[model samples]
Target: MTTKNLLVELFVEELPPKALKKLGDAFAGTLADQLKALGLAGADSVVTAYASPRRLAAHVTHVWLKAADKAVQQKLMPVTVGLDASGNATPALLKKLQALGADVSNPAAAVAALKRAPDGKAEALFYDSLVTGATLDTGLQKALEEAIAKLPIPKVMSYQLETDCELPGWSSVNFVRPAHGLVALHGSTVVPVKALGLTAGNSTQGHRFEAKVAKVVIKDADSYAATLQQDGAVIASFAERRAEIARQLAAAAAQVGNGVRPIEDDALLDEVTALVERPNVLVCEFEKQFLDVPQECLILTMKANQKYFPLLDATGKLTHQFLVVSNISPSDASAVIGGNERVVRPRLADAKFFFDQDRKKTLESRVEGLGKVVYHNKLGTQGERVERVRAIARAIAQQLGGEALAKAADTAARLAKTDLLTDMVGEFPELQGIMGGYYARHDGLGDEVANAIEDHYKPRFAGDDLPRNNVGLVVALADKLETLVGMFGIGNLPTGDKDPFALRRHALGVIRMLAEKDLPLDLNALLAGAVPAFGDKINDATPALAEFIYDRLAGSLREQGYSAQEVEAVLALQPQRLGDVTKRLAAVRAFAALPEAAALAAANKRISNILKKAGDVDAHVSDVLLKEQAEKDLYAALKSVVPQANAQFEAGDYTASLQTLAALRAPVDAFFDDVMVNAEELDLRLNRQGLLKSLHDAMNRVADLSRLAA
Candidate 1:
């Protein structure tokens, strides 16, 4: 039962930086999980993952040398079938025992060893045996293979390796990259395992250029990371390397005072970390004249094309300097800095040129050019789409504001997509809306219009900010609604994860603007209003689109910490004004906390079922038909409570409204307890049904409380 730590590593060519973290995590997690499942690793075992530009490794502590033996009980056959009337062993039973590796030389003794147990309706014969555990070699091999098979490789490269035997031949191997070496050590002992057409060993190569030694020898599982770092001159752990790079970047930025710092982007940092084995952060700069270009353009070019981090001053404006993460460290770093500056000069020059050339043409002039650019085959060109958005924006602004706001929204929506025709946006599509804002300003348009054009695509992703101003809000809503209605109209709705048009995102954006801004707009009316802009190009998808938006709203509310019961109850009403949804949810929660919530909810559920079965029963109940004392009492309670609840509901005091309805719990309970809804007389049954129908209507005005019933 002795145990020791295990270490495994795979050295290969450079891996895709974008997928490096995912691959490393999957490799270590799957390998350790397999070992635990196979009983080769204990519950307290700790696993550490190591990844670099050229290697992926894992270290696991407390792994057993061999799994423990397990006791197994297997059912043979029914006693009636396996044994005969004479109480003697049958030929079939003897054959079955022999196949299970049981001694059959004395059939009677074998039969005596089998135990009889009651199974279902009859007795069955069961065989007990001890199954041997797997050794470390076999277990690790299986775990290694399973881990390799589960790697989330972006792409697999196929290469040929020379055969190990005395034959002059090659074998093809498919992996993330070409495998050069593998190390597997169990407490300093080399474990015999093979993978990717290579046998495991204790040696691996590191830092293709800066290694102090040609080969790094991992002495033991405990010293894997330290040994690799000292001998190979590489930081094996991806997290440690990323932290080192971050620390170096901070030091360099602080050295160049004036509150200068590198731009913050985790994805860029991860990619840079994956591109280097040993990180050496160095400061480099382009010409100061490049600052005349918009900082977004310059930053995008540096990060996207050169994989560089552009520095920004305290004002969040791009500076002339940037940071570069070098894989190799040298004493004379001046040469490296100069080389990087020289390499990035041409890139910044290109961005400056595009920005200068783009401002020459006005966004107004670019409007005519969008007519040739196709948006969707079914939907017309960008020019036509712009008109539709303008129409929708105008209508929304009129409802939100007057003709003044509508006029501004119409201009912003018309020119929003004109950025797609600009040279700067064409080269860097990420800067479409951003560049539009800049160009609109150059056209002498007010910040209101320019900002709206830029922020029309705001809240692009999750947690992104919504529109800044009212005009921007109108345009953003119009822009998203146009896409949603257009796509859902043409049957281009998103399926599962395939959101080709980003309909889900568009729908969410619309919901966020409506709910967050607390706009006094109706969801159904908004969707209906946008349909006329499409003319003959779309079908009436309002009903389906409403359901889709409500579904997104429900999921979003749940993620915001509202329980499923609260969300379902409020969203069940499909409130026309999404702005009131959160208010109603708060009310429902407060009402659920009331002492009578459960009883009222249960009674409400019962009343709903009765009304449904009593089909077409009016809510009008004649006091003369109230023959039962319980019915009279319930009707009197409704008369006292309904007026107050309805007044609170009209005044937007939903919590008070629901709480007022809680007063009917006792009377509702008595009505159901003392009276049968389906009485023998037709008139009596109809009157009882009418009373229940009235109760159901009043209770469900805020939410479907029946959903709260267990």
Candidate 2:
């Protein structure tokens, strides 16, 4: 078979920057997958995706011009229905052959040619045929259409192409954007394909202004990127363009002294990359007085409003100078730098004004404004939510510390949502908690209270940092717990991926604090404490909420490399203190590696089944009822092992506790093998059950040993 490298491109208006990467990957993946499905591409085919502001393209290696022929075997019908009494072709058989595109002139010969095979209870007639392969033109057309239809387009535009020499009248088309050209090439030969009301061609438009010519002639699949870069002066690959922008930003930042560098944000870099064809990083500066505003406010306004990269000094302080990525690189770049500086001055000025006006009124006075802000319809105003959070934080703090910590947490929670009323936070909701902390400090609140207010919303997402101090930890916990319990109580539980309230994140936040921080707090008690704050607004959802938290915990633990069985073994007990979960899981892993683990686990499972059948056996063993030596030996083993295991468990040595039970393997196996648990005598059966129950209780102090059963 002969093969060639293939290329396809769609030239259009600028694509949505955030969705361009996904679109490019989907287009290339789907096209190559379709080609491979049709046998036009081999298993070894390599696909490379290229996406720019104005185009999406793919290059595939080892693609054949046409698929190879394949032999197909199709089942026709039961032999009894196709043949007559004489084993000759009947009218039905002739009609079936005709439908299959078989020559029916010699009906008898055609019937004989059909293969007979047993299918199920009846023998069926099978038709064997060689299917001709698909040509490059037809295959590419289908692939292109499918890929276009499956693009992850955020929005679609409908337009009409003007009448041309090939088409007589205007044709309506809908696409991601107003596509102007489509290029499909199999090596040097152009594959005839059409999509979005455009026909495949060897020519495509270059950069709107900087191209050497109006149109770029792509010679072949291999030369596509080179030709575009040389003639069009555009970076065709998204990654290459982003890398070039980074290089320029670094170089431009280096030109400025004092080790200043561009603030690192990949998302901003990608969006800027999608907005330009050729990047030219220029150093631009604003007035130094604008630095009076919070660096966060200034940095965010610059990046969000003007798409500029704010430079930072070695001490992580925002610098007066910033870098701008311009699409045009003029010989005299002072005009571009001056224009950017001029444009950003007003944005920075607005931020500074907001900050100055906001500080005039302390956060203590703004608490009244939150009463007008609605937090939720079922849950009352932000004012009411603040009270609930305050109460929960006080209770948590008192439990974790004493009077001083509780006072600080209460103050922080009270002022936390007050910042929502500030002009700075009102303009940028992302700065809510942060601004609150700054204002608290300005209001003469102690550092402890100020830090708590700022860190109350810590760990907004996975892998985020938790609150730094005990006061902060208490308030953060209270904030998350209130959200989880309140939402769940009102029956607003998360279903599938539709958690509009982010209850899942809140739950994980609570769990991370409890497990990672090793807080000496009971999860159930914490949830129970949060319930009273909602009063009658929420029902008692403690049980269901606890289950949801445990489910999330199990998943998180599994992601951390614990197997499902290991996690189940520890979580099955529903330990109240989540801080011990990791210790329990560690013990389970260590116990699983013991030579006696398998036998002990199986014995525990058998004991559980026996006790369950016996029904409510007391954990009291009578020596008089022990008739067999095996039963006596097992009881003695439990007496010795139970105390040692219990001592280790009390000392918080879960690994040692579980390991102590390994001594019972021999006696446990002997008891199950030699003792008759279900004896004819009722007293004997009850006594045996009691002995097993005591053994079961002892072995599972650290984890549910039965869960370790294979």
Candidate 3:
């Protein structure tokens, strides 16, 4: 029952910078989980993960040396079959006891030891035994193997390691990297474990160049990180290293005092953190002439290509100086700073050259080049896609605005894909729409068109901003719609998580624009209108695409804190104008909170069922046919309440309309209680059905009230 803290480390070649954090987290998490599953660790055990360029390690607290023994009861067989009427064990009972390693020398003694328990209608013999627990050595071996197997390795490398036996032969081993060392310790004792052809030890290599010693000697589970940092010249924890880098970057920027700061990109920071063991921030600079190119080009090149953090001024403009996270901390540091600056100059010059050469032809001239660029094998060239987008954009602009906006949107859409042909975009594909905006302005097109051309790809990801102007919004909607309709039309719908064309993102973009901007366009009409632009290339997929958009909207609404029931009630109506969905949902929520809401919702559900069963019944009733007092009262209530609700609905006050209709709950309950909708008389049944149908129609104008029924 002894417990001790445990430490495990795997030393290998540099891990993929992008996947290091995931690999580390998975390694430590799986190891701890497997230990707990084997009962070698408590539920409240603490696990800490450490990762660097060359190592993945974990430290777990309160791990047991051996799991506690547990009692186990196992069912043998039915008592009738295990024992004879003479109260003696049969051959089957003796065989079962033998297989369970029970005392079968004396049959009566074995039979007396068995407990009879009722299983269903029959009695069954049960065996009880004390199961031995797993020791730390065996449990940790299983845990270590499971952790390695479950790591989220981006790629596996195969290598050969010499056999430890007498035979001098090699064996092939596959892992994320060629692992060289492994250390597993329970407290201060080295656990004799083996993995990847390496035996567990207390020593591991640290920083490639700056380590004070050849190997870091981890003393104990509690002192592993401190010992590594002090002796190995490496920060073992990924988060601690990243924080240190940020702190140094901030301090270095303060020294270059112009209110300058490094560009904030978490992905770049994480990747950089994964690439180094010990981080030393240094400020380096390139020529100011390189700033002639768009700052985006410089920033992207610095972050994506060089893994550098480009500094920006207070106004968010790129500064000439950038910060580099070096692994080694040299005293002079001038060589590292100069070498980085020299290395980045050529990259900046190439970007400048592409930017300069791209401006000579103008975006209009490059439009013809897009014809030769294949967009999709089935969808033809980028030229064809541009034409479809232009048509859709013009149509959308006409609906949202008039001729002027239509003209602007058409121009923006036409030039939007021209950047795909530019040399700058060819080198850096992420700058496709961005380069188009710059070239649009250079081509003497007004800022409106240039802005639209750029903003047309707005909301490229979740939570991204929408277009800044009406023209941009129109073109963005058109572009996303064209992709969505064309893809869905061709049976390229997103299945599971395999959306190669990002159809889900496109659908959500369309929904966000429609709902967030409160555009006065119908969702169904937009999907339908976008279809003709594809002509015969795509089938009509309006219904399927609308469902996809609504599904995305429902998910988004739920994530925003709307309950599933509230969303279901409102979306059940399939409200065409998505802008009004929120309003409808608000009204449904308010209606659901009423004291009479439960009864009304239930009655509405009941009415729906009766009307469905009765088939087509008109919402017409004759006063003479209302022979019952409850029926007459319900008719009077409807006549009094229907007009007020209708007026409120027409005025766009959905909440008010639903509340006004709440007045019918009392009369509705009485009618359902006192009268049968399907009476024996034909006229009475039809008239009662009609009365219920009328009430159903009024109650569900804003949302399907029946869906709100408990």
Q: What are the TM-scores, per candidate, against the unseen true structure? A: 0.97, 0.97, 0.98
Q: In model 2, where do residues sit more than 4 Å from their true spots?
A: 89-95, 163-170
lDDT of 3 by residue, 17-73 (tens): 999999999999999999999999999999999999999999999998899998899
lDDT on C-alpha atoms for all candidate structures: 0.93, 0.91, 0.92
Candidate 3 segments whose C-alpha is farther than 4 A from its true place: none
How many clashes in candidate 2?
0
Q: How many clashes in candidate 3? A: 0
Per-residue lDDT over 447-562 for candidate 1, one digit per residue giving the tens place of the 0 to 100 score: 99999999999889999999889999999999999999999899888888899888888988999999999999999999999999999999999899999999999999999999
The C-alpha stretches of model 1 lying farther than 4 A from their native spots are 87-98
Q: List the candidate numbers ranked by TM-score, top first.
A: 3, 1, 2
Which prediction has more favorable TM-score, 2 or 3? 3
User: Model 2 over residues 1-710: C-alpha lDDT tens digits?
Assistant: 88999999999998998889889889999999989998899999999998989999999999998899999998888889888888987788778889989999988789878999999889999999999999889998999889999999999888898767675888788888899899998998899898887889898888887899998999999999999999998898888999999999999889998899999999999899888888989999999999878899999999998999999999999999999999988899999889999999989989989988989999989889889999999999999999999999999889888898899889898998898898888789999898888888888997888888888898888889999889999999999999998999999988888999999899899999998899999888989999999989999899999999999999999999999999999999889889999999999999999999999998888888888787778998999999999999999998888898999999999999989989999998899889999999999988998998899899888889889989
Point out the worst 10-residue segment of candidate 3 by lDDT: 533-542
Best by TM-score: 3
Screening candidate 2 with a backbone cut-off below 3 angstroms (N, C-alpha, C), the clashing residue pairs are: none
